[model samples]
Target: MADATVRPESRWYGPLAATPRHLFVPRWWSPGERDGTWVYELRDGASDPDAWMSCAYDKSLSVITRVGPHHADHAASAAVVPEAWPTSSATLPALVVKLYQHAFLADDSRLLVTCGSGYGTALACRRLGDGRVTSVDVDPYLIQSARDRLAAAGHRPQLEICDVTGALPGVYDRIVSTVSVQGIPASWLAALAPGGRMVTALSGTGLLIVADKTADGGATGQVAPEPAAFMGTRHGDDYPPAPDHADLWATARKADGESVTTGRYPVMRVNSTWDVRSTLELTVPGIEHRMESGADGTRTAYMLHPDGSWARATAPGARQVPTVHQGGPRRLWDELDRIRTWLVIDGDLPVAGAAVRIDPDGTCHLSRSGWSASIGAQ
Candidate 1:
């Protein structure tokens, strides 16, 4: 499956085909729906070799290795964890190839890439040679485990336990990250050798930022047309617990708000649409989304922001208009509708293929069709 997904002419094809993905992830978290909640079912390779082989080689499937701090290997056989967020995974093969393609590596380019399952790092070593590949991860265990697996695969590359957003270990011609970041880390700009390139996704959005280092410790490029949403980078073994939003959730779920009106469109889950979701996220970051469908063919969508704003919309069925309720200081639904309106009128959102300019302080300016927005660095 991996060989078919990676084009034969590409440099990464050979490496991706040669590496054994199952070796790096002998046990992984496989998500399944149980009742109304999501659960992680651990899949051990030794127990189910056929199922393991099928999953390991699937081109588009990412096998989750850790949920918060609970590693799949540490769990008892047949364990099922409910409502736990995945913290780490072996990234899908095609996406890894997409990132490498965006980097535009040359034969002599020294590369620094993120290490997740060690599969990507192995591919890099196979394509670019072990001496030129350097991989880093925030978790020491991940780094150590990747090093051992990579060695077992007959490749020894530099592996370090370092936060990708912090100061890097050495200079390199390219730095690619599978994890997303809220902003362009200043350290990346500083560590990139002159004229180097980077490919990374913006946090909370499906924007694939591709940029090249400049003389003044900044970068200039544009967002790719393709959208990608990688897991956000973490500073510790597990992400710091999410903040309590019970009060806000309760209001959004049931309470009548300060404003009520007929919505312009039907109740839609913004997260399910890449273009609309990306535009909305860029317009208003940090909005949690939830959607539920009733047995009577009614659909309801809720949007909650950290700033005490909440919005809920409901529609009786497909193609039916929705009624919206909003509360708090800001009208969260209005912002989302405004972005959607822009898309409807202009035929597309500026976020797709927008020009990106990163300043020395890590402030990213995105502009397209006379519209511009800034992210990060205040």
Candidate 2:
């Protein structure tokens, strides 16, 4: 995984190679489906040694440790649980390096990093020494488990059970998070030492914020050139249940919209297109998406918002312009088409490489190419 993720000359390469990733993740969850419902099939490293090494060493695959309230370590052998949001994971090695690289850690930098399965923390401890690293998690079980595994691996970083969005344990020169946040937390700004740096990704978007502490207590930086994502932070065993959208879904499927017309572009699975999805999310936050396909090569897509707005589009074949239906106070489909049109006119979206200015209160301001957006604290 180290060779595949970073060059041998890189400072991170040795740490990545030396850290025992499998020791931190002895069991994990793999997604599957049963009778049309999503489920999580547990994978135990002890049950299959070869599979364990392969998965642990995979540079691009995140090992899911907790799904909803069910943790892999305490699960029955070969147990399959119903699918829900993933609560914790040992992040993919390559992505962990990306986050660390964004931080630009120095030999003497005191680091505070988010801990899930402790693998990334182990890597940091190896590179910077255990005394300089501190790891925090909201789940007590995860913190305790990581403490034990990290000790067995011959590294003992300070592991604390605390929410990433709350008050931190101490001031640090660097703060890096493997989990996503809706916005910068005010507590983080308070915990960062003078001239400190922070690296984190925003929830529901691919934007990676990297900023250096300013004399005035705010930070200034820019969005990273590359896009990355991680599971959102959770304050409890599981995230609150997603908003109930049953009636909105039914309306999107059958009810005629306030406006119906031919779409300017072909039907798209918006969620999979990172740039488009990220821009749309910045423009119109909190929109849920769904898609379906028929046996005859027909495809349909739906977008629902919390304000009773919805959009539906259907295309007879790939690359075909879709017929669009939109309802409620806002034209959701038109908004999407406008963003797509902007992407076509310009070479790329402005969110990438945008300048970021974070206030002391954790409000984020991003601007690029005359376009600007702001994300206040959630």
**Which candidate wins on TM-score?**
2
TM-score of each: 0.97, 0.99
What would the per-residue lDDT of candidate 2 be over residues 36-82, giving only the tens digit for each residue? 98899999999999999999999999999999999999999989998
Stretches of candidate 2 exceeding 4 Å from the true structure? none
lDDT of 1 by residue, 18-46 (tens): 99988989999988988977898888999
lDDT at 13 for candidate 2?
90
- Itemize residue pairs with steric clashes in candidate 1: none
Name the 10 consecutive residues with the lowest summed lDDT in model 1. 1-10
Query: What shift in Å separates residue 247 of candidate 2 from its native position after superposition?
Result: 0.5
